[model samples]
Target: MKHPYSPGRVLCALHFTLTVFLLVRGRPKFLWFRPLSPEKLMDAIAQLGVCFLKLAQVLATRADFFPLEYLDKLKTIHDQVSPMNAEEYEKVFARAFPDPSCFSFFDSAPLASASIGQVHEARLQSGERVAVKLRRQGVDRLVEKDIRLLRGILWLAQPLFSRLTRNSLEAVISEFSDMIRRETDMLSECENLEQFRKRFVKSDVTLPEAYRELTSSDALVMSFIDGVRIDDKEAIGAMGIDGEKLISKLVVFYMEQMLIAGFFHADPHPGNLLVQKGGRLALLDFGMVKRLSNATRIAMIEVVKAANERDFELYILACKRLGVVAADAPDDKMTEFAERIFDIFGDARLSASSMRDIAFTTLASMRDLPFKIPQEVVYVMRVSSLIEGLGTTFVDNFNGVKDVLPVLKSNLTRALGAEAGLFPTIGQELAGLPLTMRRAKTVFNDLAEQNLHVKLSRETLDLLEGRIRNMMRPICQGGLFILAAFLVVGMELPWKNEIAVLLFAVGALRIVIGLK
Candidate 1:
């Protein structure tokens, strides 16, 4: 095991601790030594190194938690890093390939550098051009150390912020750790690339083909793609590509990925997407991807369907089913949340800013509520946010609802057809309608007749019986008091006096018991 007292780790821990302390103090201007701002906090995280940088990237997705300015600063956090020198690359390369002659040409300089690793352009002996990605020296150890530090921080702070720590904070860190671990494992990336490449064969999206024999857990080799960055509108225009059409296709591609394919590239930032000559999109970086379960996909479809139909109740139901809201959440709170969400979508054209504002407002409203975000749904939201952000950048006056509704409707139609055929589904429901109506009618009639009965569990029955006894106790005590007074006034016998006394004592006892 590496020593726990590394200088780098100690500096990172101190930097994080101090930055958090300042933020908690909430008096950035009061610092005598230096000016502090949200931007400075972002810089602190960036300087802490790759693990912290990755954390900042995840934090940027949470518009609900952080301010827009902070998010803006963190959003600029990229994978760009100082490239490793030739000697370092050669040493790492030798671990993956025992002999150095497997490649005809290998560039000493890196094509791109990220926090965990760097990619270099290379050509195999067979003359195939490929991108060789190698993990940074000792990145695994660094990440493990950083994660330990972060976990310790979370453990220490959990008691102070119980509400935030109830689930989200720990969950976010755990998910990030899992994601980063997978990302560092190049074999996983190779698998993702191959899967996406196979999945998008019928679509216009291009994925670099992975060379399995040349790939290892520490290194990966894939077909190198040469294309302009998708975000470079001028370059795309120069190539005579229709910008609007390209954006539309991109949106459709993601919609299919989420709704139909049930798997999607979770990260689609401008840097990771490239455009080939025919406007074909070449997707890079498969380290972070999301796969939706069938139930979740259906629930998402239901939400879209409800939104299109302007049915808030159905939308809320869909949310509940999707685990977006608690299963036992109060109807009023869910309705309020759903209405707020609807208000955001009620407008005809929904821009990325409007969506983000809605997210912020919704989160603010739900801050005091028992709303919980499921782990699976977090990735879904991240992917949706990225797609919306990309759309906003690529297209002017982008209407997310307008662009997404048609694809949703199409997918729904296809799903319906595949499940039971649309007409048969309708027929099945129609066939069951009379029995349902009959049952409803019978229940209404029973209620009108005052003969409606509810089945209760033994526990519930005991509770109801206890409540009835309590209600009767008050009336019984009052009756006993009156009886005792009558016996004291109207009867002259010694026995009558004793009976009145006993009656008074019983009433007093009843009162005492009720109080208890």
Candidate 2:
């Protein structure tokens, strides 16, 4: 029998040659190949078009997924990107804005470029310094074409790539595409910038003020910040101040954003952060920001609190919350990891050097077991690691554990201490936590009862509605996935589109009904 869609003769020949060459170059036992050097890989990616560029982007934020060495390497290209053609920029600008004469402050050469697009430093009619970010010309078409090509390539390469083996390649590509698509749309970036602006409206944390009139789906104009990148040591010392103090404030500001405000600057590496007078940490690039769901928030706070207090049980659950360990992780593995955590903190109590080693060792071990680090922790850990790296480079004798110990101790005590109101509050939050078992119970209980039904109190309908909203989050998440799959399989077969769309409808119904 003949199978269609087989590799062509030339491709087969090339693949065989590459495989043989890799086998000679790499470990025979693992069958691991020596991948292309980073520079060659980056060059290959650029040649592959914007989709591969987007893939590189998703890889950039996934610091937790990679080992320390790989993470260190990724940092080098965190913002370094080859600029797009200048003539293409003119077309994008012209399409986005009818008249180039209107934005006379435009510069042809880009100040910086990235997977999403490039930024050009420009001035406004009001004589204010601003950065104009322009979307690449024909980006939407490119995205559509590249995504189609990417799906084909992923489908083709699934057998060879180890990372894509255990996980769903379709899911990974979907996440990557969704992220880049959102990035491509300047409207979304504006929304993100506005969302971030609202988070720090009156704080020391400064966000760019977006100029709506000068913005469109393809271009964005916003206030330009002038300050040294937080990573640059000489610049900070040149300003005549304590680098450690500035770094400390940065740690606190970002922590407050994630813990208190729930809107975090997801890409808070030193490059994305700038330092100015009075220890102001200017936050740039809101493209990768993440908002913690209330349940996730409470869960994260509990997890960190547990680590600070050495509560093994809470620690296990926290690992579960972060998706580092399965909810059903073997008790021995759980105990081992828990003990490891205690030892790490115990050493951390003695010195900062110990704390860093402990965290790295623990993370490395987790990699051997290899579980998915939840998206929130993935982003948080990257930001946290960047902070740690910046501290090492810019601050003197920096100890994150020591600096954060007081606040952490306070929070942990507040969470676990037997004080009157504190215990009750902790209990309430604990009870309210989103356990998978609870969701299963709700679903099956309704199914066992042989009909979907709801009981509502007339007097507290508003409160009842809000309570349901809290319960329906999982359903909403399911809806997004269903819609994505529907978009994929629609053209494949008859009724498939309808079926996929129906799945989406059911998901939405679940959410709306749950909220009710």
Task: Point to the candidate with the largest lDDT.
Answer: 1
Tens-digit lDDT track of model 1 for 1-516: 234456775655555644443333233533343223566776667667888888777756665555556667767777788987777777788888787698999987888899888988999999999998998877888888788888887776565453422356666778778888888889998998888878878887888889998899889999999899877888999999987778777877887787778898878888788999988989998988778888787888888888778687887777777766555456788777767765665465766577667767676667655454556677777766676666656554355465556555665665433556767878988999999999999999999999999876322443465566667777688677857767686867778867777777777777766667
What is the Cα-based lDDT of residue 267 in candidate 2? 68
Off by over 4 Å in 2: 1-34, 37-54, 57-69, 149-165, 168-172, 341-370, 375-377, 395-516
Per-residue CA lDDT of model 2 for 20-113, tens digit only, reads 2233223333234344444555445545555665455455544335444544454565545677776776678778778666554777788777
What ranges in model 1 sit over 4 Å off? Answer: 1-36, 163-165, 345-366, 396-399, 415-516
**Alpha carbon lDDT of residue 318, candidate 1?**
78
Clashes of 2: 0
* C-alpha RMSD values across all candidates: 11.8, 13.6
Candidate 1: Cα lDDT at 403: 59
Each candidate's number of clashing pairs is 0, 0
Distance from true location, Cα of 416 in model 1, Å: 5.5
TM-score of each: 0.73, 0.67
Model 2 weakest 10-residue run by lDDT: 1-10
